[model samples]
Target: MTNKKMRVVTCPLTPNQLHDAQLDLPKNAKAQAKLLAYFETTEEDFVPLKQLREELGVSGQAIQKLVDNGMLQFAEKKVNRDPYAGREFERTEPLALSKEQQAANDEILLAAKEGRPETFLLHGVTGSGKTEIYLQSIAEVLQKGKEAIVLVPEISLTPQMVERFKSRFGDAVAVLHSALSHGEKYDEWRKIERKEAQVVVGARSAIFAPFENLGLIIIDEEHEATYKQEDNPRYHARDVAIWRAKRHHCPVVLGSATPSLESYARATKNVYKLLELKARINQQEMPEVHIIDMREELRSENRTEFSRTLLEKIKERLERNEQTVLLLNKRGYASFVMCRDCGYVVECPNCDISLTYHQATRKMKCHYCGHEERVPEKCPSCESEHIRYFGTGTQKVEESLAKLIPEARVIRMDVDTTRQKGAHEKLLTRFQNGEADILLGTQMIAKGLDFPNITLVGVLNADTMLFLPDFRSAERTFQLLTQVSGRAGRHVLPGEVVVQSYSPEHYSIEYAKMHDYHGFYKHEMLMRHKGAYPPFYFLTLINVSHEEERKVIQTIQDMASFLRTKLGPDSIILGPVPSTISRIKNKYRYQCMIKYKKEPTLKNELKSLLEHYQKEQAKGLTISIDVEPYVLM
Candidate 1:
């Protein structure tokens, strides 16, 4: 009657014993031999009794005869599902740590030994042995009879991270992420609740791991925007980790190459302990960066996506049998389809954005709303047959590489190419095994990639995210460039970087070229100060959406007016305007942004506003609130 137990028919005797036993054989020797042949080859310990009668053409009487002869039996067994049931990891010993890493580890261990709820901002360079410090800290935590939780930024990072942890901790590690099935997740969760798992490594949700004796929590790539849940029940894993650490009296470590402005600001203010790793392990030098201006290439009549300098570097790496990583920040075959005759473009019907043409599928897709349509032969507005695709994407770069350098092998990684389960790991494995010479990808390839042969790194278009409306665009651009640049020269071989940019003189690109995080931080802080943005003032975004534009505008206006009265006079309320890329899925969106240094009652007022719109929300109108919002659009 147990839900986890099932009745199955199993062979009680070995195949040789059954064959050797003297007995009166059935007259239908064919049926007897057929059933016996299955037992000889079947690998399963047991099969469902129903499958035996239905699939094997055997009746209950035949099975009962075997049971009576002590050859087979029906047993009820409990079902257990383990995600890593068949995988075996070789145990690894701890590597020698650098002096800076050892110093950081000592501070963390001191805090843990005293049961202090300290939050450490481990700001290390990309190749500065941050992960080794994390592992050593966890080793001490485990020795104290306490459990630990590690949160990675994305599922793409889990496979590599889990392998590292499992190789050290073995079966004591449990994985929890969206990629696992419901049953697998349940089993992992049960293992945690039952105190069977000592360490949990997974994506964001692993923060909720149920371990009563928790001692340490680690958030890798702590600055990643993916750590913030943008949807309803929104929460930042860092905040949650801090909250849980306070309850359990444990230390929480935030490890990143480029820490967020908020975290860095806090570290400067003495609110969080800061640890720095200035040099790469074993004295490996940082990659030498060269910024190539595309305008100069255009003047020279070289119109391909790759600048001459980048192309030469790629070819050099190819000839040496070293690897290369090409980052284009955008996906699809082309950014959009536009008509040369009328300046008209193909746009999605449901969203106020152009459709991206996917060369493999031969269809134009809307990145925001999942809308699709065929490419038009003639312009919709002018009825002219002069359609052309514009903008460089990963697919386009891949195509150009194949034609321009026919011998170069390229592997493309983007949302389009990595949609299937295990596709990310498979592609990365192929690249790591030296199956491909060049690794072409979008943002996912910007971090957590370590390969020894990758001596050359190229950024196809470094200005892709530099001009977004969001205030954090400059910070993000610098972080991405630095992260992708670190993929080269990580080991014994020296590394080089080629950055192709239209705005090569911009500070973000220049600082990234010099690998100067502090310079970019100081410059960006001034810009943020002038604009009254984050780390200076907190922001809350109130978004309203409706099919009717008028309704959305009116709703946002009312909310802004109501907030003006409820909040203090010092607060700045700016909005009642449409969002960038405003319309999505036929919904017209409007937002109100609230910026304040301190609004003691702001949370309560926002809750009251939601209560006032309870009826409006039920009738095709949607309202959402994001505090310390990552993306404004």
Candidate 2:
């Protein structure tokens, strides 16, 4: 009766875990000699006590005082996914590459000696190391013994990509994320089903890492709309690491720096294989990007959140003590509330919009159904004490940088300051040890933050995700202002990025203030080819949902009339409409979409519209389907 996702936890090794094992586990006697090498192995080695207290960096009250002194027991067992056989990895010397990263590592080492599957598109440019060509192409696929999968786009990029792949593959890196715990993701999915890790750094479900010699698959930031997965098994970790690198024949790569215009139109139609790092690591200088105009700082200094050219570059990086990151693509503490005598606003009765205001939980929330409350001294439909708030976030730029720079010090890093579990590597290791002079956040500190005394970044509000009615909101506001202006200075100082914008002539903020990703991918691929969107039409959507708003418009108008007779007229379709926040926690949505560029029975008509809504989900209805959907809401 208990195969509830294969449980675990069982062991025996007491006498006070072997007499306080060299002073309460002096570096876990190799995780208690792999917990007595799982009782001389077999029963497929029982582990999951939250993966042996996260591989013995102990404490769930020191493993419940070693299971109340008898030294552990309690199992729905099957655990021992062992591998860190007492850490000893050495092979270091890689970093020399840069002659266009050695001609993009000689065309990915001639497509990994032509073993078959290939799909490159690196297009690197944010500090151009692209994690040193993904740790020298996963150290040439761990020198031919194979296995590799990188993935990344956020579990706050799993602690700096698992501390640079466990400082270059020590204990052969294995991490999967939903921030672990499902017994540490079933012990890193049984260390790649017991091959015991040959490098798997995670996030985006490490593209299902149970590799069978999968020689390589990288995807770092690959134009991240959080690498797609928006729910269910919605996949798209870069199309599931190019379908598990074509069933493990090998090479996938994808890395990026603002690259997604459908992977730069499938790497200019060769169907992927375009490298181009084009300078940063040592060829430094891609910063100096100004553009301020907050509508002339709200018409000449009536000012609205800094823009005297970002307070003269945050007062010259706080008198050269250098370090500043600002960016505010929304995060509560403003950007909502409102009334000022019956114009009234304050939304989110279950989510259409506007609620925000969180100033360290003074509450108002509902950044789409989180639904908190309390901050309304009037105006709940106009009892009008003139309530107001309106725009700026990251807790109103950390309380307007402590009331206009009272000797700065900030830190922030959003989602309400890192909700626990190594809070985004402890606020990015205290803003990389300078102990914060200013690092405000949101947009998850906008991509691969490498802080070498972070000279200056200050974006504040570059069209907070450029007015999203979402056609990839101007490619996520030009990839969040070119990855938060490639986190300034990046190494040997020389940086600068102001931005501000009310709409400083928006060609996605003038192609992200001239760091122009191929002029914002040719003006957003001619506005996604005159708004048909995606690399020339391929979206899907569907949605539906109910709690009975006319049965969510008669189940999305009978699935858009059964997807226009199982899709035809060369596709198109569009709406059953009402979605963008059409009732959230209470359901009521609607959608449809389709778009298409040749469907070929669109995945068996979206698996027969999810098995006809699994029998109309017992009459209340629901549905979801997204496919290539980086948000339609």
The numbered model that scores best in TM-score is 1
The per-residue C-alpha lDDT of model 2 at residue 373 equals 82
Residues 298-416 of candidate 1: C-alpha lDDT, one tens digit per residue:
99999999888888889999999999999999999999999999899999999999999999999999989999999998899999999999998898999999998999989999988
Alpha-carbon TM-score of each model against the true structure: 0.93, 0.32
* Root-mean-square deviation per candidate: 3.4, 27.9
> Model 2: clashing residue pairs?
45-79, 45-80, 46-79, 47-79, 335-391
Task: Quantify all predictions' global Cα lDDT against the true fold.
Answer: 0.90, 0.77
Query: Which candidate ranks first by lDDT, i.e. highest?
Result: 1
Worst 10 residues of 1 by lDDT: 21-30
Worst 10 residues of 2 by lDDT: 77-86
lDDT of 1: 0.90
